[model samples]
Structure formats: C-alpha cells, structure tokens
Target: MSAGWLRACALVVMGLFSVCALAKDKQPTVIVIGGGLAGLTAAYELQNKGWQVTLLEAKPSLGGRSGMATSEWIGNEKTQPVLNKYISTFKLSTTPAPEFVRTPSYLIDGTYFTAADLTTKQPATAEALKRYETTLDDLARSIEDPQNPSANNTLHALDQISVSNWLDRLQLPATARQLVNQQIRTRYDEPSRLSLLYFAQQTRVYRGVSDRDLRAARLLGGSPVLAQAFVKQLKTIKTSSPVSAISQDKDGVTVKVGSVGYQADYVVLAVPLRALNKIQLTPALDARHQGAIKGTNYGWRDQIMLKFKTPVWDSKARMSGEIYSNTGLGMMWIEPAMKGGANVVVNLSGDNARVMQAFGDKQMADQVLIRLHAFYPQARGAFTGYEIRRYSTDPSMGGAYLAFGPGQISKYWRLWEMPLQRVAFAGEHTDTLYPGTLEGALRSGQRAASQVQDLAAGKSFEPAKVVPVAAAAAAGAVAAKKGNFFTNLFGGDSDKEPVKAAAPIAPAPAPAPVPAPAPVQAPAPVAPAKVEPAKKATVKPVAKKPVAKTPAKKTPVKKAAPVKKPAAKPAATQTQAQ
Candidate 1:
C-alpha cells in the first residue's frame, strides 16, 4: 500500500476508538429503588440525562401510589408541574369529572347544615371560630413560602405544639373541638399527631387553591394509566423485586435485590418513608435522616366505596351527598352514577381508618351502611355492593402522606433534601413545598434526577425549574442548544444549569433518551393539549414543535371523539382506586 493510504487508514481507526470511549464514559448508571410515581419520574429524568436506569418495585404491579392518580390530579402546573410537563409533552388524554356534590352544603351531626354552621351554631361558638381562624391565618402567613415553612421565628412556636394542643388553647367548645378533630382526620392523621405549623402550612396550601378554576379540573385515564404510560417510556423496570440492602462506598453503590446485587454509580432511594426506614443501609444514614424518618409518621386512610340500588341521596331529598363528619366516616361524597361506578365514597382517616382496617368485609360494609343511614335513611336498602381500598396499610405503600408531628419539620426539613455519598432521595417526603401531594412526589423525583446529573458533572446540586407553558414556546430554541439539564429537550425555560447533549452511540440505550420524552405524557389526553402544552411547545419547538403543536391543534377534534370515550370509562373505573 502507498504511504499516504496507510496513514489515512490508521487515522480512521483512531477516530473510531475515540468516539466509542466517549460514548461509554458519558452514559452513567442509576438504580431507582421504588416504582411509585416519584421513582418512575426519577428514572424517567435520569434516562433523559443519558443514564441507564433500573427501577425496582416491591409489588407485582408498577403503580406506586395509584390511589392519587385520579382524573382530577394530573397536569396541574402550579402544583403538579411534573405531571403537567408529562401531560403537555406526550399529549395525554384527560376528561372532566362530575362535581363531588351538587349541593352547597355539608352533613354535620345527624342534620344537614351549611358548611359554616359549625362556627355559627351559637354566639360563643362563632366567637371561638373567629379567634381560631384569625390565629390560623396569622400563623399560615408566617410561612413566607411553602419552600421555607420556618422562615419566621414566631412560626417555630408552632413546631413545638400539636394541632390538638393548639386547638385546646383556643377555648373551643366540645362540639367544635370534635368537628375540628374530625376535619383533621379527613386530612390523614388526628390533631394530636399533626404539628400545628405543619397543619397550618397545609391549610395555607388548600386556601391558596380557593380561587382555582374548577372548569380546568380534569382527570387523566387514572393513576394506573399514568403508571403504565410512564412504564412504556422507561427502558428498564422490574416488578415483584424488593431490595434487601443498599451499600454505597466512595467508588459507587451496590443494591441487593433478593440475592442478586446490582452495582451502579448512584442509587435513588424513592420508597415510602416507612418502607425506606426498613431498608438496611450498610453504613447507617446520618443521624439527621434517621431522626427524621423515626420521628415522622404516616396516617391511615381507608376509602370505602359503596354501590347503591339507586341514587338514594339525590332522589330522597336527603339534603346533600357530601358529608364531613366526626362520625366513623371522615369525608364522604357521591359520584354522578353510571355503569360499574360506585354511588357513594366514604373516606375514613386517622382513628376511623385504623378502626376499619381491622374489620372484615361484612363488618366494613355493615359499619358503612349503619353510619350512612343517619344521613339517608334509605341507604341500607339502597346499598348493592362495596369495595375498599386500604392505602395506609398497603404493603408497598406504608401509608398515606407524611404527617409531621410537633417539630419533625424543623429538625428534618433539609435532611430529606440532602444527598448521601452516591445516594439521592426522591418522593413526596423529600419535597418541602408540595409534600403529601402528587405534585410533591413528581417534583421530588425530578429534583433527585437533577442531583445525580449534577453529581456526575462535578457541580453542586440545583433544584429542577419547571418550564411554564406560557414561556415554553419562546424558550424552546434556547434550551435545546444550551442542553439545560432540567428542560433541555422539552424546552420550556432557561433557568437550569446546562449539560452536554447525549452522545450518539451505536449500541447503548442512552441514544434512545430523546425518544422517551415523546411519550412521557401520552398518559393524559388533553391537559398537555390545552394547559401544559403551551409550555411543552417550547421544549418541542426544537424538534417536536411541529408534531406536538399539529397534533395538539387537531386533537381537540380527534380527542373529543375517541380519547374522551376511553377516558370517561377509565375515569369511572379508576376513581375507586383513589
């Protein structure tokens, strides 16, 4: 061969090796230790970062918190930004559910009263209620932002007391106190188990939503559909496999599932706090994390769904279907009846939930009918069938959302956010601003995903910035070129730290990361089409601007016909899961 040809051949071979080495180096491995929305989200985000992700679920199924994936819970940008991002980017189908109740009232004692009757029952009660409201609002205001609940020193006083204690000092009457305790039970835990500041912050979050546009409250197919939609987007996921131990050293981490061990650069521990505390970490976590996990508690919630022979509440003029009571039932409401749909739903929390947890099917059904009879005398005969979903005692899910008692938040607020050596945390517990809500779980997962990415780049961690639907279109082009770790491909905003683009590789799964986002939101039909798509459009503007927008514009007509039909039926089926 000629000297020039020989030289060219050597140069070509050298170039090939360099490219191969770079591809191998750029792809990192992450083991997500849960299959709930938070863990799924972390896996999804890490996959976007060109990382290999393996998700482990203890249960046979993949949906972690299927109870919360109702038609009304998806794609809320202000609260549920992660789901909102999915709704926009993937064009998930969504539909409106009937109002929880038709009447503007609540069931109290054995009589129907206006929602405010408890406070206005008498002059003394009204005055006591006023003082209570004023104190709650004042304390809530002390929380400058949900992100920092203890920003005010005065608020720390709340961390030292329980809601029950706080209420006692308010001088509320016996009836009023029982009513408040029941209301707290509806939330998750009893007043004594909840921190006054924690409860106040939560109240503030709810009050913040007093002005929400209910017209926009829509549901995706359901939580199961959302979970499956996420499953399809991910490359590797395992079910019915529980991790026994996780040991992280200076070099990397090893996660043992059953007898088999999987090694990775980092591990995202995303299980529920109760389950999390059980897992054996080789080098026990820091005192702060141990303390937080030990001190925090989970509330019990049992959803008793009843099917009646007819819409008894509506036909009998029983005042209303919605009831918030101190009775065995904490919060009860009826759905607009249809085939396969339960007529009434009784959500029992705290002590009530615990009581029902030990009851047999017949006992549970009997207890529900007996209590429901007070509001609707015709309820017993009208009852046809019953189904119960026990979230608090689910094997995979230790219980409902985390309930902070006394001062758990002050001592452990930052611990949940802290990352251990080659270990990161994600789940509702880690989210400070939106904890206990689906929004919190999703945001926490995204945050953990970003932490691993930052760890790999040798940079300090930064929280994930949710790209707004309004700004997505404008920011799409800029985000793609910059490769902002948070919103790069799904281009919505430019607030995140930039990372390098996925290195095109021949055999590795990292090359397929770009395609994953295409389907992240295919779970919800219209939320992305209408609400978040505005922001997602920016992310897609880089490449999917045409496909995403074109389909969104047309889905209004198409989604109306096909998607809505399936969506409506799924809404009926899945509402019971919640």
Candidate 2:
C-alpha cells in the first residue's frame, strides 16, 4: 500500500468513529425510579428534551400520596404558569374553592364562628394572631437567601426547638393555642414534632396565601386524573416495579427491580426519603445524603370518607360544611351535596391517626361516627358507611410527606438537593420551596431532569437557582394589592396594589447564623463528570400503602341512643406518625 493511500484510509476511519460517538452522545437514556408525580415529571421533561426515558413505580398506580383522595390542589400565583402549562396540556379542569369553603368557619371549643367573627368574637385572640403572623413575615424577610436558610442565625436558633415550644414562648391565649395547634395538626400532622425553623419556612413560602387559601382549588376529577394524564404522555412506565438496588459507574447506571435489571445513561430517584432509604445504592450514597435519607421524618396522614343517605348537616342543621375539631379526628370537610347524597371527608394525622389505627378499621369508623354525633346531635343516625386509608404503613410510601424534626434541617438540607454522580434526587422532600406539595414535586422533577441532561451531555450540573423570598413575597403583595382574582382570593393580604408577579417561590428562609470555622477547610468531593456505555441489567425483588375506599352504602337513621365517650389518653405516649 502506498504511504498516501494509508494516510487517506486512516482519515476515513477517524471520521466514521467521530460520527458514531456524536450520535451516541446525542441520545442518552435516563431511568426514572418511582412512578409518582416527581418521577413522571422527570421522565416527561427528559423525553421532551429528546432523551430516552423509563419510569418504574413500586405501586400499581401513580400519584403517590397525592393520589389517595379528593383534596384541593393549591399553588402560589408565581407557580401558576408552570402548573397551568401541565393542566392545560392535560386538559384537566380546576375550580376555585367555593365561596362557602373559601373562608373556613372555625369550630373552636365547640363554638362555631365565621371568619368575620374572629375579630369581633375574640378581638384579643385576633390581635395575637395578627402579631404572630407579622413576626413570621419579618423573619421571612430577614431570610434574604432562600437557598441557604441555615445561614441565618435566628432561624438556626429556632431550628433547635420544636414549633410548639416556639408558640409557647409567644404566650398565645389558650384558645388561640388550641386553634393554632389544631390547624397545624391538620396541615402538618403535629407541630410539636417539627422544627420551628421548618414551620417558619413553610409560613414564609405561603405568606402570599392565607390558611383558607392554602386549600386553593381542586381538579374536577381528582389528583389521579392528572397522574393518569402524565402516565399517558410517558414513553415507558413500569408499574409494580420497585427499585431494590441501584448501581452506577463512570459509564452508566443499573437499576434492579424484582428479577429484571434496566440500564440507562442517567437515573433520577423521585421516591420519598423513607422509600429511598430502602433501596441499596452501590458505591454507597454520600455520607451526608445517606444521613439525610435516614434522619428525615415522614408525617403520617389518614383519610376517612363517610357517605350519608342525604345532606345531613346542610339540610337538617344548616351548618357550615367544614369542621376543625379538637377530637381524635383532626378535621372534616363536607363535600358539596352529590345528587345521590352527601359525603364528609375526615382528615386524621400524627398521634390521632396512630391511636385510631389500633381500634381496627370498622371500630375506628364507628368511633368517628360517634364523635360526629357528639358535635352534631342530628348526625346520630346520619352515617351510613365509611372507608379509611392509612398512608404511614405503606411499604412503597413510608409517610405522607417529609417533615423535618429539630436539627435535621441544618444537618441534611444541603444534601437533600445534591445530585450523586449520574443519579439525581427529586421529590417534594428535596424541594425547598413548596415542600410537601404538588408544585414542589413538579419543580423538583424539572430540576432533576435538567441535572440528568447536563450529566448525560458530560457537562457540569448546576444547583437549582434560588428565588429570593422577599422578592417573591413582594410580588405577591403587589398582586394582592392589584386585586388579581386568584391572588386576591388566595394571598392573605388583599389591600395592597397590583405589581408584576415575582420569580418562582424561593427556598426555605435562612436559619440562625453559626460561627465561622477556625480555619478554612477543604471542600467536599464533587461527583466526577463522566459518561460510558450501559451494561446488561439483573433482576431483584422489593415491597407497597393502603388507599381510602369509596363508601358503598348511604343509609340514614332518624335518631339514635347516646353513646359513651372513650377514656382520655396521655399525650406523652402518643407519637406523631405523619
């Protein structure tokens, strides 16, 4: 062969290799673990970005905790664009909370009072509530950097104590405390179990919206409708496929579920902290990440639906359709009267739910009915049948959502948001803004998708940008002032003038400050950037939560005999489950 000929042959071979490499790089495959909102969202985003994606869910269905029942789907005005994009794309219908339910009628200490009555009936309590709210707003403003909430000394100090302790320190009236505690239990499943910092951060995130507005709107059908829509758009979704183990190398990732193994260029883990802890990760997760998965607490929440032969409370007593209770059952929301009859959804959380679970399903239902009669004498024979859902005992989902205990936030907040090698973590738990919410899950999924894309392209992954709390709140304040229908309805402050909506909601407020290290220390190891071909997969086996069931019968009774009350239990022995 002539020297010129040999040179030309070499050049041709090199050109072919380059084209092959480029093609391989362009079509990276991602494996999404968990078929919940976060995983589905990650898959959707990646697929739209031209990446091949596979989603594996432990449960037979999607939606995770959000799919359990009919409830409101609330989000800040800033998150409207993102939420609307998905809602519109899926053709889902949403209706704002009805006027009757918009402003909750408080049932405090057996007394019913409308929202307007709060200021008039208990002026002192109202003033105290106002002062507490103002304090939270000021603290939220002091948290200039949402991304590093722990950087603030005040917040850090607050993190050292439970929310109950903080409230006690405020010296709120006993009735006011009861009202606040009831609200906290219903929303977060035991404020005493959560850090003050965590509670404060949540307050800041929702500063734009009032407590009533928090349950802003509901999908026409339910959360599952949206979940099903997301499923339809996914290229591949394997239900009842729980990830038992995950192994990643310089080249790609291997996920093992039951007896089958799947390989992809990248992985997105969208499971809750509890579920994530169950999966074995090869190369081992970073210490901080592992600690976070193990240390974080997931709140327990149970829902019981009761169907009646008729609209009992509304027709018989002319009562407001909602009840915030101090009983074992946390709260109840009477659904709009259906053509057939009416239904009341009872929310149980924390220790209350745990205690009731021991009473067995049927007995628990009976107990709840009995309690209902106590509150409403006319309700004695009104209940027909009921169904209960226990989320805490679910194998796939350990709890309703993440709730940070005292000190856990500072130790693991940074780790929750970090990506490990070719794997990225996402879920409401990992999201700082709108934590434990559908909006947070979506935002986290989008973020993980971006990170996975960058990793596949052999580019450095950047942390999600943090929007300033003050700026977002200011925008919300402006919108409230302007009288934007949604904003005015949801945001707490309606008197302010209109201004442009701010950036996406920011992260948790900054924590109390800590002293600087004596000397600068070396930075932690960063996940190396690399990409390689995926290898053949192997199969392994894994475990699943009970869902609330629809009531079958709607029988009613005209009247019933009085029932005995259960003995009082010690509070110390009752632990918050969710």
Candidate 3:
C-alpha cells in the first residue's frame, strides 16, 4: 500500500472509534409525554438523576389543569413541601394566599339563610348536615390507607354506589340532599358520577396532611412560573408536539411526533387518559389496561371570571363570601384582592356547565349577570366584562380531571397504576392518595420517576405504599370535630385570613351598555360522534404565545353541536400506570 493511503485509513479508523466511545458513554435518554405537573415533575426528577430527558407537551404551555386559570391556587400544606422545593430550587418567590371575610349565610332557592335559619328555617337540613359530617368522618377513618381504601370491605361496598345513592340510602332531607349534590358538583365537578368511596378518600387525604383548614395558596406569578422553572432545567422540551404513536422494542422505546422519531431508554406517559387514547401503541395494551382507559371518565367544568367596578357581594350586600345557587351557576366567589383589584369567579359544573356550554361567551356572561342580579339587585350594571375558560373544549386537556365512576375502582384501579413494558404512567388519575388534586399529580410524578429510575438502573420496582404519618392522624382528630363541612368538603377555606387590602383601582370607563342577549333555543341532543384511531401523519409544531393573564373578548355565539366521544381500541386505550 502507498504511504499516503495508509495514513488516511488510520485517521478514519481513529475517528470511528472516538464516535463509538462517545455514544457508549452518553447518558440514557427518557421521553416524557405531557408537560403538565406530572410530566414536568417526572422530567425534573429524571434529569436530576442523570437521565437525558426530553419532555413533550401537546399544549402551548406547561402545568396542565393547575395552570389553566389564574384566579386561585388549588393546593394544601402537603403541596407546600413539593412547591417549596421547586421554589427554592428555582429561586422563585410566591405570594401568600389572600384572606377574605366570608358571610355566615348560604343562598338556597333564591332565599338567603343565616346560621339561625339552619335550626328554624330548615331544621331537617341542620340534622342532615350533622349526620353527614359524622358519617363521612367515621367512614374516612375506617380506611387505614387512603390509597388502598378498597382493602376495607365497608369502604369497598361504598365504592359500588354513587354519592347520590348513598345520600338517598341515608334518607337525607330534601334541602340537605340538594346541598350535598351542589357541594359535590362544586368540589369534584361531578355530583352524581363519583363513587362514595372515592369522595371519602379525597376527604381523608386532605384531612391527613393539612395543618389549617385546606385553602389553595396562589403562586405569585401563576402556575406557569413553576412550569417555566421545570422547563429551564430540562435538556429538551418540544411544546405543541403531540405524540402520534408509541412503539417499543426490547432495546428501547420509540416515540413518534410528526415526522420525527425520538428513541429513549424509557418513556413516561403523563398525559390524561383521554389524551393518551388518541395515540396508537404497537403490540396493543392488554385487556385490563384497555378496560381501565375506556372506563375512566374525565370531569368537566367551566370557570367564568367577571371583572367588576366593585366587590358587589361584599359584607355591605349581606353576602361576603362564596354564593351557591340552583340556577345552574353552581358557585360564585370574589377572588382575594390583587394589584389589579378584585373580580368575581363563577365555577359551573354538572348540569349547570352543560346548560352554559350552549351559549356564546357574551351570552353566558349575560346569563351569569342575570343570576347574580337575582340575589343582589342593587349590584346591577357594576359588571365591566368577563372571560370564560371551558375545560371541556381544551384540546390537550379533554376535561378538568378524572372522576372514577362506580365499580371502576376494583376493575381498573390496579391496572391503571401498573406500568406497561417500556412505558410508565403519571397524572392525577393514577394517584389514589390524593386523586383529582394538584398534590396527587405531583406524587404520581414522583412515583413514576422512581419507577423509571429503577428500570434504568436494572433494579426491581414496586409501587410505594401510602402510610399515614403523625400529621394525618392528628389532623384527622381536628377534622372530625372542627371541620366546616361545606368549606372543607369542597377543598376551600372555611376560615378567613387577616386581610391587607390592595388599593382600589379607578374603574375603567364603562363601555357601551351591553344589551341583554337573546334567549338561546335549546337544540335537540344528538348522539356523540364515534372517535376513530388517529391516522399516521406528520404533525408540525405550531408556534403559540406564552400563557398570560389577558382579558378575553366577547365573541358571537354559534349553535352548539353534540360532542363526539372518541372511539377506543385496545392499543389506543389509556392506562393509569405511572
């Protein structure tokens, strides 16, 4: 061989060896599907533990249900430790929860009832409320572990019945029955759909961990702040890149997003079960996993924020706090005063949310105003404008959160928590200890991250058992005696914090008087459309603006159409395995 030819071959051989060595030494890669709390937490945990993490979020921003609204933070003391860890890690600041003076009265059937009215105006209701508090507390205590309440036969029996049926069996009075239904709707966003066991488990989890009455502490900038913190630490994050399919082999997992394929040693599927159903998985999921996904229902609720010239439902109006109504406007409350001033937020769920979804944005706002006027006539014309966030319509998040229907716990709960080969799960739905709450999402993520770590490290992994700590035991005692049934039941504050009021802003010049919207004619309900398997196609990432607190404009209403349900196949079915 010529001298020059030999030198060239030697150099090429050395370069190839260097490339192979670098590839062999690279850290294992993990692809997290979903940028919500669970997804972000999984990514953060994996990254810290030496995994090269790539997070994919279908939405334009992170922090799934937690970041959807800006009015209030929905979490408790248990959430504080996880949140504080992130805040300290990110060097971010948070605002203390706002304190408000709540009126000691409740509005029912157009008439406001005071504390005395409980005995005189509605004696039966008073009796029922007492019974409810006692019964639920006793039931919550029977379950040694909130995460595995099914182990208790009594609790398991309750799981077979809906909350409505349980109340019926108890022979609750009419007003009390209505109040309980309303409370469930406001709290879980599903009045009749949730099981009694599920409801009790949620109650105990909060009672176990919270120091004070449970109240959501607001993150000063909003949930996106925490999301941003997680994003900054991530090695790669592809927002607006929805996963089309997931295929796994003995070697690694391949995630398909549009035309690109990302291969990772392991995968974390953190999206909602409904969202997960959209993606096709090769070597279809087993029967139990498929059944769990098909059986799970995502709860839906609509949040409406009305900016006003003043706090119309303040102490002067004889109603200082949240107001409940039967008029399909489930619950209304004024947010704590902020730098921008105070505003009223109406939460619509259950039948109320369904009724409101038919109208246009402005029409819905008008209807809400009409309902408010019925209770406080003097507050007419104080309305400035409104913004609506319909969780049902969000593409990424099909609904607010998962609500396990009756009989689903035993049939699907275990399957949902079990990991499939190469793919682990994480989300609020997978968490039994604190289901449907922000804390649950974080815990599930931690669990999934641990599982991923074990898998990558070739260690056997088992789901962690939830054991009650001293705080939960002590809190349980306090909750049994002192808990305000209505407030604590709905995961909000029953006691007010001392207020440091913000300076009031000069009311914006009143816009032209908005004429009352024409009454909308209800359309006949149509059968839900059948969802089909997603076609294999490249999905381009669409650029979206960062999530910001902007005023939503009034838009013209269009006739509503029936919402189609997505068709499910075994492989496309969702699993809660995290």
Reference-based TM-score of each model: 0.72, 0.76, 0.72
Residue-level lDDT of model 2, residues 1-578, one tens digit each, is 99999999999999999987676555567888987778888878877766667788776567776644454454324443445557877888887766676555666655566657878988887777666666556545544455556443334555666767666656778766766676776667566677766776666555555544444566766656766778777766676678887876655667777656776767899998878888988777667777877667666677788778776655434445556654555677777765576778887776576566566667767887877767667565767777776666565666668777777776776565667777898887887766666766777787788776655545554554432233433433322334531223222345454443321223323332212212211111111111121332111112111111222121221111111222111111101111
**Runs of candidate 3 exceeding 4 Å displacement:** 1-24, 67-71, 74-80, 98-105, 109-124, 208-213, 315-323, 339-341, 378-380, 460-578
Clash count, candidate 2: 26
Model 1 scores a C-alpha lDDT of 0.59
Question: Considering every candidate listed, which one attains the maximal lDDT?
Answer: 2
lDDT per residue (tens digit) for residues 241-318 in model 1: 788777766556667766666767778999987788778786777686777665576666667778887776665445
At residue 71, candidate 3 shows an lDDT of: 34
Could you report the Cα RMSD, in angstroms, for every candidate shown? 17.4, 16.6, 15.8
Q: State the lDDT at 134 in candidate 1.
A: 56
lDDT of 3 by residue, 398-504 (tens): 66777666666656664556567668899888876555665567767877877766565455435444332232223323333444322233233443422112111
User: In each prediction, how many residue pairs overlap at the backbone (N, C-alpha, C within less than 3 A)?
Assistant: 15, 26, 8
Cα deviation at 575, candidate 1, in Å, is 20
Q: What stretches of model 1 exceed 4 Å from their correct place?
A: 1-26, 68-70, 73-76, 97-104, 114-131, 315-322, 340-342, 460-578
Give the range where candidate 1 is weakest over 10 consecutive residues by summed lDDT.
568-577
